[model samples]
Target: MKFIKTVSLAIVGTALAIGGAAAQGKTVKIATEGAYAPWNFTGAGGKLEGFEIDLANDLCARMKIKCEMVAQDWDGIIPALNAKKYDAIMAGMSITDERKKVIDFSVSYANSPNGFLVAKSSPLAKMPGTGEAFSLNSQKEAAEKAIDAVKPVLKGKTIGVQGSTIHAAFADKYFKGTADVREYKTTEQHDLDLAAGRIDAVLADSTAIIGTLEKPEFKDYVMVGPSITGGMLGNGVGVGVRKGDVELKKGFDEAIRAAVADGTITKLSKKWFKIDIAPRS
Candidate 1:
């Protein structure tokens, strides 16, 4: 009787595991911002070409599964993910403790700090802290020093950033009340405004600014000030999955780690952003 009972328990465990696997294998839909350039923005021809698109494709290849990517507004991406509009989100979203409460992450695949973008000829291009890196969490003293140094040059200047992004968070943390912060729905729209002299400077992701700098219309725009991460900027970008999908989350985590290990992510990052930012270490 003891042996029979043990065998039954083992069989039940196996059945439960198989059921979990089957549930995870049921198609996954990935969502992206679809407006942030060099991340997941739509091109002039309405084609998606950017870092997130490339990395998402690479991860799907690693998983050896058929997946669909949907373009949605950034503000609604997370809520929609929770609402089942998509199984996961691949936008350039930082994995933070607050965000963790509502969803899970599939490992961070890429990271670039919040950086400043300005017209090449603008005085803001000469702002202090140029070509430097600082972390608000690791080295608060130095990060504040950098902020204090840049404050003078940015004083009373209008800064443009996308609405509801980490950039906005950073502006609130460091530049709020000091600089006039304007928010835009799309990076392209702000890029146009910056080109038209509507805003003195723009704060956003480094890779996104690279996309803006590549455009003929923004031929003279440049990155200035310090590259910042950690603290309010939060952790690196990752695939956000719904809560309670631990099986699906584990599959994606394994696939993402495998892709990074095989250099698939590095290759795609370079292909799209001209940089190599695979899983860090």
Candidate 2:
């Protein structure tokens, strides 16, 4: 009788462990700002589609969880995640220190630099260091020089950026005094303003700029200036979760690593951004 009871207790414990695992894998609610094109966007039928969308599905599959992706406004994405409206965020969110103070991020799956979009005829089109790349953390002097080189043309010009983003922070820090920085609610809004000549240029992710440039209306537009990364740009794009969700974080981290190793991210990035934005590390 003693041995039978001991065996029954062991089986109960095993069942409980299995039940916990199943509950954890049941479903993961993910949020994405369906406005950031090529990263994520609303399609013709109000369906969410983009690089991050595909990557989110892949990551969820790797973790053996069903993913339900919901479109959330960009400005409220982080707060919504904290409110438990969603279990995770795969909205091309960069892992900046300021953001990390609130929510934890999984291993970065992609990294892309930021730049300016200007009309071909604009004086800023000739902004110096056109094809150069700079890491403010690794090469501060050169990056600062590159930044200074473009300031003259940018002086007195108005630049548009999506509000509450790193690009906005960058413009505020580096170009505020020299140039008028206008914050828009979305990249599409700023692109419209740029097309209407309301703003001289738009500062944004290179991938996003490239997406805009592909449109027929933007035929005359071009991405100018150096590609800026590191420093204020943060540590690349990752899946964001609440700070206390360690198991969920671990699952995403492992999934991302697996996806990176298998070239899945590279394939999806090329399909969307036409460039490899895979995290270097």
Candidate 3:
């Protein structure tokens, strides 16, 4: 994801006006998976501190609403939201068509590509398009070419991905027949398995993998293969709201627009991920 370079003052002003008008002084309960580092995770004292946590606070302030953030397991986040356990979800959830069928999404707040984490000593480390980013929609040929190039190396390899995630979907779509796909409840579980040499590789968001690589235990692992985006990965990350909550979605969308217009998202992203992943205007 590229850094947000320029923001239109006019857009900021418009967003603020909309946000002010939409403000209802209502309390909004937001849920996040506390395990996804640099996005939303538990800190030293079990307090949530990360990009999405900060962004959620900023957006809530902009919306003039009281916000309560709760850490929910990734696998059950959506179900809990539908169960009315939370008004919204600020987790690092991609806005895919399948998810949209059950919940509405605010405008995207951040954009990060997905990739693989493999041991540096593995042959898969030399997979084609090592540092290149591919969008299945705009760069279909290039993405397919990279996938073809890596297929041979991936054949018969056991890969792990967090269940109910885009990474899992991608593995099922691309490697089901060629590779052994294992699903875990959390990325941390798969990361542990990767370190134990239980899985040949793990596929996940590049941002998440960066966090994993920073840990001393994962020193042997490195992000490899082509950076993936588009298609099933969906359009960046957005706040998930119930389908009936149109007004809530509108309020969040306006706040997100304001945050993007003023560069708050980009600023927070850098502070957390050390990279600019603000959604492109």
Candidate 4:
């Protein structure tokens, strides 16, 4: 009888320990820029909404972890993550080699191409290659040709891009001396400057520019030039994590893969972006 009691107590203790470990494993805080629309943004009453928010919740549930979403500035996000301000970043952050040196990233969840937004009346709108997709990795010649085609039109024109983004990097690399590149703290600010004629063109993600162009005030604005991807744009959008947080990165990677396999990412993409931007297998 005593042996039976001892064995039951041992089982209970093991169960308790497992339960405690599971509880301790969860409870992570994630950061987003809240200014990047459709991917993430502040909605009515300042509530965070959009694709990343929905995707974050879904990924957290699949990981069986409790997550808290916090809004952080775009430029400061990585530094703050390294400072331990958040456990992960889901604000449409791309997986870039430059960023990989400081932090780690999970498998890409989505890949939205970048492009230029210009007023329909602008001469730059006449630049060639309307709907062509250019991959710097696989289609370097084509991407370079497209860049060369637009360089003449953009000469002496001021292009606005969000600072610290791939778009900014692209602008610096290709248009620095050819055109004046203006950097803004947020996409919204650049959109405003573009709308006000303060900047001749804006370089940003196609989906984000679509969000702006859909607004009644931006009726004259249209996305132009080749849709760009790969190369300096990075591998795609992924969850950014601290370099040493391998376990957390693993959890997010597993959750992202499961979501991709189950079509949840496609469903969410269509809902927010009106198109499927899920990373190709």
Model 2 stretches with alpha carbons more than 4 Å out: 1-25
| Residue 191 accuracy (lDDT) in model 1 | 82
Candidate 2: tens digits of C-alpha lDDT, residues 122-177: 98889999999999889989998899989999999999999999999999999989
Candidate 4: segments with Cα more than 4 A from true spot: 1-26
Cα lDDT tens digits for candidate 1, 1-281: 00100000001111122113335554456777777778777665555657777677666655555566677877788898888876788888988887899899878888788778898798888988888999888888898899889988888999999988888877887888899999998787788889889999989888888878887887777899988887777778888988887866776788788888888888888887788766586
Q: After superposition, how far is residue 62 of candidate 4 from its true place, in Å?
A: 0.3
Q: How accurate is candidate 2 locally (lDDT)?
A: 0.85
For each predicted model, how many residue pairs clash, with residues at least 3 apart or on different chains? Answer: 0, 0, 0, 0
RMSD of each: 10.1, 9.8, 6.7, 9.9
Residue 6 of candidate 1: its Cα lDDT?
6
Best by lDDT: 2
Better of 1 and 3 by TM-score: 3
Candidate 2 similarity to native, TM-score: 0.92
C-alpha TM-score for every candidate: 0.89, 0.92, 0.90, 0.91
Give the lowest summed-lDDT range of ten residues in model 2.
Answer: 1-10
Point out where model 1 deviates above 4 Å. Answer: 1-25
TM-score (C-alpha) between model 1 and the true structure: 0.89
- lDDT winner between candidates 2 and 3: 2
Whichever of 2 and 4 has more lDDT, that candidate is 2
lDDT (10s digit) by residue, model 3, range 1-281? 21112111111112222222234433467888888887988776667777888888888778666677888888888999899887889889999999999999999999999888999999888877888889987998888788787888999999999999999999999888999999998888999999999999999999999989989988887899898898889999999988877778888898899999999988998888888999996
Worst 10 residues of 1 by lDDT: 1-10
